[model samples]
Every structure is written in C-alpha cells, then in structure tokens.
Target: MASTEAIAAAFRIDPQILEKWLEGKQPVLAKYASAHQQIFAQFEYIGGEWHPKLDRQSSVAMLDEPSQSQNAVESDRVQHPNSSEVDLEPQSTAMFQAVGIVTGAVHLDWETHKHSAIINGSTYPLFYISQKRKAFEALKAEVAATGNSRQRLIVYPRVIHFPNKQRAHEIAFQLVGFDKGQQTKQEVSRELLDFEFKLAGLWQFIPVCRIPCISIFRNFSSERLDYIKQAEPAKKVKFLKASHLPLLWKDAPCKPFRFNPKAEGDQGHPTFVTLKVKFLPERNVFSFVEQLTPVQETAPPFLKASKKDKASLRRQ
Candidate 1:
C-alpha cells in the first residue's frame, strides 16, 4: 500500500504534512467532499474492505522463469503474511486521506456534541474532544482572548473523506497552542485560516496549494505486498557503474522508487544492483536514499559541427 511519503511524492508535496495526521484520535478522518472523491478516483477498490488499488508498477515483481521459485515461496510461507510492526517511515505506516484540511482554532460546541472550528466562513465539526477533554479545557483556558497568541487546531481531513457518503464521518484532529512571540512557522502547504496565518507569523500564504495531500490508509487491510520468493543466492558479487557510483534507484522526491535491477536473475546474487523486487513499506526512507543531480543541458554535438561540415551537408 502507498504511504504518506509515497502519496506526497506522487503529488509532489511534503511528507510531514501527512505525518501529523497519522494518529487518528477519532473513528473517521474527514476531508473536503470534493477532494475526498478525487482521491478515491486514484484507486479502484478491488473488493471487500475496499482497499485502494495498486497500479502494476508499484506492484511486486513476479519471477516468470523459475519453477523452483515455488521452493522459495514454500520456505517463506513459514513467515506470517502480515506483521504487527509499524513502519519506520510515517507515510508507509498508514493510508490517510488528507484533503482541504483547514487549520484553525478550536471552539468546542456542546450543542453539536463535538468541537467546531470556523474556516473561510464555514464551520466544520472537529471530532476527538470527548477523549481529549482535559486537553480541550486546557486549550480553552490557555488562550482566553487577551493572551499573546491563540490556540491552534491542526485539523486533518477534508469534507469528502469517509467510509461512505451515506454515513458522514467525523474529522480527526490535534490541538496545538503556542506562545505567539516564541513560535516559528514553516510548512510545505496547508489551508490556514486568517487567524492561524497570524499565529504562524505568515503575512501571506506562499506556494498556495489547490489540492489536498491525502494519506493512504491501510487499516485492517488483508492486502500484503506481493510476495517475493527468492532462493538463496550462491554468490555476493555484483557490477557497479563508474559514474553512477553504487548503482542508484531512479527516485524523484515523492515519486515511486525505480530500483535499477528488476529482480535476482536466478538463485545467483545480483551484483552492482539493488534488486528492485521488494515493495518497501516506507517510501520516504528508500526513495530518498539518494538525491539525483539535475541533468545539465549541453549544446547538441550535431549542432556543434564546424561550418565546413555544414557546407559539406548543404552541397550534398
């Protein structure tokens, strides 16, 4: 499954934006109705729990030639198909849907039986106050009108993200309050309400993002990375590129990693190649292993031909 890092990489946003949303204190992570639908459009639900679909590329590579690979599979079957371990990379840990998440100050509402925050002239319900009531009251008390700064709510999810449209979901969130004078702000992109802007010490939003950076959730998912069955390699030797140095995966920041070699050639070990076979749980870790230098454009060799050559061509 895609991680927050993968999604961020795919959409070309910052990974930390989704990292803040990982621990959902509420049942449903909400998002903007329109943006949620847009995310769903990216993956077709295979069936059952409706796990997001995996395109063929992010798909695990299959070995076609080796009948003996079945022997490798049989050995690996001893290991459980799934793991209880959380991924080291935050993005790979879960699939989150973050869209049009508006950051604002929390104003808990007893009437609505939930907290509500106002943004862009719209009041959206913020869930999780019941569990974090103590923190909620602390926030309310911390910023009481005349303070140096106001409390901030790092709301996650948009209007559209939900289990289903028929049953609307509660938006998950976290409460962050800081001393305005001491606070320093930085972000990849987010929708900050006017007051939040002042709190962030931002005069104007820079790199205004129109699209929401959603997290790819993988809870209770029966899905597993496509099983890779490799027999023990007989040798450890491999080839290396002189210029490329230590063969690299063609990775773009926030893009799917393109490992150099597809898979092990046989029971033999791959040299000078990091087998591209495994679908890593964390995109941020492996994908950012190397930063590729930009390709500098040089005048075409053909164009650099001497005037004598040009005259020769014209005569021909």
Candidate 2:
C-alpha cells in the first residue's frame, strides 16, 4: 500500500497507463504479496481503503533502498513503470507532445485572424496587432481567399515593464533605430514591424519600457555623489552610457524624457524610474483609427431651421 501522495505522483506520471495496469486479473498477485509482504503488513484494511500504519518497517526499508529488481515488481503493479522511473527523457518527450497537442488545438480556433502569429509554440500569452486597418483587412482577405479549414493563427497580447533606464533605452533603440540621421520615421516604423514579427514568432507580444536613469545609477555606479552630480542640470547632462532605451508606439510621437524628483533616493542616492508598455494584435492602421473614432450625433429635423434661425444659431 502506497501513501496517497505517492499514488498521486504515480497518477501524474501516467494516469492512463496506471489505470490499465491496475485492471486485468492475474496470478501475479501471489508473487506481489510474497515480495511486498512487509508493505502489506503496514496497512490495516479499514472499510474499503487500505490505511497505512507504522508497523511495516520492512516496507519502509524497501522504500529507502530501491532495487532495479524491485522496480520490476513495481512495474507489474503499475503500467509504464519504466517510463515513470527513467530520468529526463520521458518527461521531456511527454511535455513536447503535450505542447504540440495544445498548439494544434489553438490553430483550430482563430485561424481566420490574418497577421496573427503564434509565439513560444503557442504557450506564452502575448500577441501584437498592427496599428493599421489596411494591414488587418489584407490579412482577413488573405485568410478568406485561402479557404483554409484549420485554425493556424493564435495571438496573445503582452504587457512589459522596464524596471530601469538602460533596458528601456536598449529596447527603444532597437525598435526606433540607432542610425544617427539615416533612419526616417518610416524606416523606424518598418524596423518596428520587423521586430514585432520576430517577437510574434516567439511570443504573442513584448511590451518594453524605458528603464529609469535612477535605476541605472543604483545598478552601476558605486559613488552616490557622482550619480547625483551627473544627474543635476548644473552639471553636464549626459545620457547614461547604456545599451537600451524605452520603447514607444510606432505612430506615437517621441516625448521628451523627464525625471521624477520624488523618485530620487531618500538618502540622496539615485533610484530607477519604471515605464509601462503593452502590445496587442496586428491589424491595419486605418482599421485601428476607425475603431477608435467616436460616432457623431445627427440633429433632429426640427433643428434644421430657416436661414435666419441658422444664422442666429451660428451667432449664438
């Protein structure tokens, strides 16, 4: 008789196989009884269940020393005992198989959504929708034209927060481009699209924020005074020599960077500022605008008045 936890662990390893093993009558019961008599001795048959007691020291001893021969006996008791005991190989195989099944199921659902990309083998929840309406429309049309029966598209939105300035700068630099004057906004936008596509393949979406300058100081510089002096307006203000900056939306205008005075350390040490970012599904830019537009109210027929009244209304 095994403890409930052990039984549960066995079930988790392979439930169906265990079930099959438990079924089917065989004369092997006598061999099991003989080999594991100590195991049986520890348990008192209470009602329909076997309640284990401490009296079975020999059974406990067996547990402490697992023999390959004993495993054969255990295998007889449970289906796929060999699989359950074999190290990482079986577990990894099972996990990969499970992922494939899940991905297949997701592909069956929203395959119609064009421009939708699955990330992380359809595991992590993150996706990006194009900010353009035409892009979305094209995707929908393409999917419709293909007449594909299977769901192949799975997209998820992700929210990312930058805990420090350096990381945010790096991400922003990547999306917006680092070329001094060669990169135009359009070029930057295209680069963003490429970045989005690459990320979409691995994850649904990645929202990256600019790391706070203060955080960078806390992470790198040893002298708090040096950090403060460099940060002050009186001193030569320099962008911290870091790899990355925060990411902004493709169409959104770049805003001037500002630091929070309150965010400064209480002991005159510097701290990092945080930024928030969010990624969504890809669609056409026009469609996004249309979706965001508010409907206007039409005036009643009575509101349509004579020229004089209209003039008066205008004047009012």
Model 1, 1-316: lDDT tens digits are 3455555454444456434433333232354334334445554322221223333221111211113423211111111112222222222221212212234455655564456565444555554322233455665666565552234454333222222223322223333332233233524123333222111000110111111111122222323211101111110000000001011134323222122234543322111111211111122011113222222121111101122322343365
Worst 10 residues of 1 by lDDT: 235-244
lDDT of 1 at 186: 26
Clashes of 1: 24
CA deviation > 4 Å runs, candidate 2: 1-116, 123-134, 146-157, 160-186, 189-316
Scored by CA lDDT, what does every candidate get?
0.27, 0.24
**Distance from true location, Cα of 244 in model 2, Å:** 13
**Cand. 2 TM to true fold:** 0.18
- lDDT of predicted model 2: 0.24
For model 2, where is the 10-residue window of minimal lDDT?
Answer: 93-102
Residue 141, candidate 1: Cα error in Å is 1.1
130-214: candidate 2 lDDT, tens digit per residue: 1222333443455466664223222222222333323311110111111112243443233332223211000011122332111
Q: Tell how far residue 149 is off in model 2, in angstroms.
A: 12
